[model samples]
Target: MALTRQVISTLQDNGTDIMGPDVMAYHYPDASIISGSLLTVEANHFAVLKSRGAVLGVYDTGQYPIQTPDKPLLGGFVTGFFGGNSPWQYEVLYVNRAKLLVRASGVATSAEMAEMVYQVDYYIHVDSKDDALKLTTHMPFSGHYIKADEVASYAAPVVEQAINQVVQVTPMEKINEHIHEVVELLKEHMSAFLSVFGITLNDAKVLILPKDDRMRELISLRAFGLSELDAVRYYTALKMAERGLVSAPNMAVGAPFSIGGATMGTYPVPDGHASVTLPKG
Candidate 1:
């Protein structure tokens, strides 16, 4: 889509800030202007074009010298033609364009402005259905009236599919590579510790003196019969501590651990207890 320099200058003169550098203006029919921000003169020309399905392309000198051409002129030269200004002022330009009917208007309310901006931004920013879904899921009430349940039902599957596709593809192997590096480092450190302490570094017996003392505490908790999943949770807690990720109170020594539902405390185990109860799935 193209915009004439005349149109750009007029918009600027009328206090309409040129939003993006690429907006170019051109002559379009009345129907097209109905969905666009229109100038009064352009609207009249558009009306004439719509009614007659044709209009004479006057020479830049304001002379109606040529017959209405059969084919639309996609590009052409025009000098300062006298409709409202100098005839030699013709400069052709292209604009980012889309058509949207005015939904509501009256000395613009915030809601109306938001709706207009949303329509334009959605058309420009959303490249695919998944992107649209992400936008809708994250901000469900942007422009139109949509029920919450309906929005969620419609959006969730698309977002889930996009996420699954991203995860399953495994395009970047950096995390896996990093995990391997950490394991190798742990192994080398363990071997050295074993040599110094005169202990065999068997896989099962490896002390796994985690990279830090917090990790050692988590490992100790896990070794004392915490479930593997719970061990991971404790490990995450330890990692957060090591990274200063949170500011929660420190866990007191020998205090009970409480998560979503499970609790671990320093209760005495009966002597001769031969079995442990596991959580029901």
Candidate 2:
């Protein structure tokens, strides 16, 4: 087999913002790279060559001859340019290694089955050659450019899954108190899950709160020296008393209570026994 070097054409990504901040990847419309053509990859970008769902080669930030004389067969994709202008039909995808922002917001079920609303703003990027390949292979986009929205769309479910994984084991009352821990756990889970798609879950800021007023009230009660059971009991009793189901004046708990236009007072407790049990929230 005679290896011939032919400069049929030149292939290189040219643009002011070749790999912009929000861009994830760029698919060159031309799916053919002639042998011996110069392939220029910008900094913080990777040029991946794939043919028929197969990745032929991955070039980093550098200039290289696609099919050099040294290696006639470019990863076995090119046998020879016998016709002298033969082009290897391979998809050219430029993956940005620069950090990109992906924001995800969703509702997760907490340990007590409470709906927890979460909003996460995180940065991610294809860190390595393997990750770049993973990004191109796992998350394929049809258009010429892959934008942040596309990355966000792919990451939203993963973020939701991570939130559920962490929130499901965490009680609503402790969500805000242990928020830092929650953020760490979310980052850990998200990083692991998104890595499968070649996306690195970089630094993130996660804000989680109760989805409704009832859950908010419950969490607030827990913040004020009240246990989960106590918070629920107090919250439920307060609601019941507001609705006139429980007697306001006859209430016998130490906590202060006040309803609209009602006299504010602490429930009196009898000696040698706990106060009346309030219905669960």
User: Which candidate's TM-score is highest?
Assistant: 2
lDDT of 1 at 230: 69
> Hey, what RMSD does candidate 2 come out at?
9.8
CA error at residue 112 for candidate 2, angstroms: 4.9
C-alpha lDDT of all candidate models, in order: 0.29, 0.72
Q: Judged by lDDT, which candidate is best?
A: 2
Residue-level lDDT tens digits of model 1 in 79-174: 223232222222211111222111111111121121100010100112222332333233433222222233223323332332223223332222
Candidate 2 lDDT tens digits, 1-281: 33344322123336266556778898877644555667777777888887777777888888777752334454434344444333446567888888888887889888899888899899988888888898887886857788888877877876777667768888776766777876787788778878998888779998898899897887788788888787877786787688886553343254544455454543337784545543323
lDDT of 1 at 271: 75
